[model samples]
Target chain A: MSQQLDLLFYSLSDQTRRDILRRLTLKELTVSQIAKPYKISLAAVSKHLKVLEKAKLIGRRRDGKNHIIHAEPKTLIKIDSWIEFYKQYWNESFDQLNTYLTTVGDTKNET
Target chain B: MSQQLDLLFYSLSDQTRRDILRRLTLKELTVSQIAKPYKISLAAVSKHLKVLEKAKLIGRRRDGKNHIIHAEPKTLIKIDSWIEFYKQYWNESFDQLNTYLTTVGDTKNET
Candidate 1:
């Protein structure tokens, strides 16, 4: 799978990770701080961070032994653009089909 | 996994289906015509169509004996909106972090 698409979906698929992202929405936090809300082990949280990292949805820097996790919103712009570009294809077709069904039912007059 | 997210990613994760979507980009196609480009089976292609249908990315209707598959673009707008909403969470945090790094880095700054 393409990394862009992989990261796009992979980042959003996990419930715990989505929760973490939601938390990060409020503020940036250290790894342990982000881990505080979950009953899962810190190691599991660490693993989640790894997934986010590979997706480029989060960035990490060490503050002594602690890692500050920051959300990268721009990382999603590509994915947005991708989905946006392809959207016209499906959208327009459905609209035409709707028109066809509404005003031209088996008229066979399309050029 | 949530069905919305499941359908979102599950639909796009496959190469054959993406190709099918791309072809649908040019025009709507029947199951057999859609299957022509791939080395895979017509049944496999039908399975792919089912996935797209489950995602609500495509729809089907019978014209006599042919199943006319039409692209449903509106289905993607929800996904686009979902991504757009979360994007703010990431974007703001990242911008704030950038600001913190730039002008307030460990300088005994008061919040």
Candidate 2:
């Protein structure tokens, strides 16, 4: 799971890959179409696609000779859950601290 | 911002660092206390702390000779916002597709 997340984050860490993902989120596009806006070579774009594919963030379908790439939004849900876990953990800790402080205040009032 | 996220995700890519973040989330702990549970060397744990610090996921304060490490949950919020942007984008696209499909169904029924 950690390795999967590592690949997912590493794939997203690049500007070009993120751009590709943003574009893919709108609609499925051919490899050439996705690569058209960038100044990088087709090979570079292919490399980015490979990374995205490895992370399962995007899926590729071959239609005749053209490769169609679409964003896999579900993978993002996995990341969301991971972040949510930490968010809840932090919230719980803060609640505990708040309770402790309140108890301390009540004790001082009694004194 | 991409670079900062790259650092943030990169710092989290490792299991040890994630564990450290989890521990810090519970309460502030000294470098020694954080390192005590693991079999690795103190230097190795320190290196992990450095990565977490660079990502701003954890902060250290010098109290006498001890460096107190605490979790900075706000950095996770930045990541949450980034993910939320994509989530909204994908949701909007899905809504558009749903509308189009509904229109197509109505046209088919009218025929």
Candidate 3:
């Protein structure tokens, strides 16, 4: 599971791959079409797509001659769940700290 | 910014590092104390701590003879924001797809 997440985050760490995901979110497009906006070669774009695909962040389908790519939002959902768990953990810690401070204040006032 | 994020995610991409983060969420501990739970050498644990510190996921303080370490939740907040942005984008794409499909269904029925 950690390895999978590592791949997911590593794939997302690149600007080109993130941009590719953003573009795919708008609409499904061919590798050539996705590569058109960037200065990088189609091969480079394909490489980025492979990384995203390996991370399961994107899906590809062969459309006769062109390869169509679409963003797989489910993987992002998994990432969100992981973040949500830690976010809750962090918030709870803050709440505990707040409660501790309040108790200390009350004790001081009582004295 | 991208480079910083790259470092952040790369640092998080390890199981040992993630476990260390989970431990720090509870309370601050010295380097030796943190190393006590894992089977790895103290030096290995220190290396993981350094990675987490470099990613701004944790902070360290020198106290007398002990180096106290604490989780830095703020960096995770940044990561949450990035994930939130993409989540919204993904949701919007889903809505658009839903709308498009409904329109196509209605058009088919009309013909």
Candidate 4:
């Protein structure tokens, strides 16, 4: 699980790869179409795709001679689970802070 | 924004760092207490703390002779936002798949 997360987070750490994933969310696109907006070479775009594919964040299928890429958003659910743990902790901390502030306010009013 | 995400994701890519974040979420502890569980040297744990600190995922405060470390989960809100986009996309794709399946089911009934 940790190894999978390492790959997923590492893949998401790059701008080009994140952009590629976002584009794929819109619709599947051919490799050449995916590369068209970038100033970098097709090889560079292919490399980014490879990283995303390795992380299972995106998948590719062949259509005739072209490679079509699409986002695999289910893989991102792992990250959502991880972040949810921290969100729960964060909310707990906020509740504690609120309680403390209320106690302080009550003391001030009594004084 | 990309650079910050890069740092945040890169910091989370390692198991040790993720573990450290989880531990800190339980409660703030001194630097030495944070290092006690791992077999690695205090220096190695310190290095992991530095990476987490750089990503703003955790913070430290000096108290007398001790440096207390705590999880700064608010920084994770950025990740929540990023993941939220993918979740929405995933839901939309599932809806489209459901609609397609319904159409196919109706056609089968007609036959």
Candidate 5:
């Protein structure tokens, strides 16, 4: 699981890869179609896709003569779960700040 | 924002960095205190801290002789928001699958 998180985060670290994943989320696309928008070579795009594939963030299905790449969003739920811990800590800090502000407001009103 | 996401995700790709962030979430610690458990040299740990600092996932404050390290959980909110888009897509697919399964069940019942 730790290794998986490593791969998942590493896969998302590149802008091109993230763009490819975002596009795939809308609809499945063939390798060539996926490679079209980028100025980079097909080989470069394929390298990014391979990283995403290794992370299980995207998967490919053979469609006759083409390979269709699609987003695997379910794998993202794990990242969500991991971040939940920190989110809770952040929320607690917000609550504390809010309480402090409210007390300061009340003190000013009393003054 | 895209470049920031790249750094944030890249910072999280390593286990040591993630572990350091997790530890800081509990309480702020001096650089030496943070380096205590790891078998790696202080310089190696400092390298991980530098990555986390560059990402703004952790922050440092000077306290007399010590540099205190603390987790910046607020930075993680951005990642949560990014994952929100994919979660919606995942849920939509789940709903579609549910409708299909229900229709298949109805057909079986009629037979």
Candidate 6:
């Protein structure tokens, strides 16, 4: 796939993954429970979890026979900050700050 | 390529694309002007532009013989709102909004 905001967003783009995130948002749940709502195989949900984990959008905790997933908000916040930077396209001060931020350390490596 | 945030962010993950975006942030430039800094051929820059256009990160304006690229901030804001949603992973009231947003959305069809 692409990489930057792409990976982070695409991880979320999938309907199954989104549902899983929604279910997790409601409350952390076991893998099977998270998978229960979908018609796909449990392994499919497992793959989605792996993707979410790689994206760091969610973290998994082993609880008894099931793995419980919790949302990790930091990376998500980074994406917000990046997206929020676009406001600079319209706001002057935001523009200056964006110039500073984009040109900041290793931004070319952003994502 | 993955369609969700993945496609969006991944398009951005490349150093060359980031530089192109940085240049655009400074001012809109023709495709050739945008291609000058990169050691790669114009064809490569053109390819990147295609990716950015598909991602909707930038829009093109054909002026004379050049294509002037401009940033499209709306989609970025959508990403922001999405990332912002995870903030609800902590804030309870935000949780209500999250449910309202995600479940209300074609959650499974997210991207």
lDDT of 6 by residue, B3-111 (tens): 6455566566666776687678768888989999889999999999998788887899887887789766555665565556667554565678877887779367766
Candidate with maximal TM-score: 5
lDDT of 1 by residue, B1-111 (tens): 366766766587666776787677667888888998789999989998998898888888999879988777677776677677777664665688888887766556566
Query: Residue B33, candidate 3: how far off, in angstroms?
Result: 2.5
RMSD of each: 8.0, 5.4, 5.2, 4.1, 3.3, 14.0
lDDT of 4 by residue, B54-83 (tens): 999999889999999999988999998988
Better of 3 and 4 by lDDT: 4
Each candidate's DockQ score against the native complex?
0.32, 0.40, 0.43, 0.68, 0.79, 0.22
Find the 10 residues in a row with the least total lDDT in model 2 chain A.
A85-94
Write the residue-wise lDDT of candidate 1 on A33-108 in tens digits.
Answer: 9999889999999999998888887888888988999877677786687777677664665679888787766556
> Per model, how much of the real contact set is kept?
0.44, 0.43, 0.46, 0.79, 0.87, 0.39
Identify the runs in model 1 with alpha carbons over 4 angstroms from their true place.
A87-111, B87-111
Docking band of candidate 2: acceptable
Provide the clashing-pair count of each candidate structure.
Answer: 1, 0, 0, 0, 0, 24
Interface RMSD of each: 2.6, 2.2, 2.0, 1.1, 0.8, 4.6
Arrange candidates by TM-score, descending. Answer: 5, 4, 3, 2, 1, 6
Q: Candidate 6, residues A1-111: lDDT per residue as tens digits?
A: 235455566576676676677678768888888888789998888999999888887898787887888766656665666555567664666667777887785356666
Clashing pairs in 1: A90-B73
State the weakest 10-residue window (summed lDDT) of model 6 chain B.
Answer: B1-10
The A-chain TM-scores of all the candidates are 0.76, 0.79, 0.81, 0.85, 0.86, 0.71
Model 3, DockQ value? Answer: 0.43
> Residue by residue across A43-110, what tens digits does model 3's lDDT show?
99989999999999999999899999999866888777777757766576678988998978846557
Kindly give the stretch of ten consecutive residues in candidate 4 chain A with the minimal lDDT sum.
A102-111
lDDT: worst 10-residue window of model 5 chain B:
B102-111
TM of each candidate vs. truth? 0.71, 0.78, 0.78, 0.85, 0.89, 0.68
**Candidate 5 docking category?**
medium
Task: List, residue by residue over B11-109, the lDDT tens digit for candidate 2.
Answer: 877878888998898799999999999999999999999999999999999999999999997688877888886787546667988899897884655
How far is A68's C-alpha from truth in model 5 (Å)?
0.8
Q: Which stretches of candidate 3 lie over 4 Å from their true place?
A: A89-111, B89-111
Q: List the residue pairs that clash in candidate 3.
A: none
User: Among these predicted structures, which one has the highest DockQ?
Assistant: 5
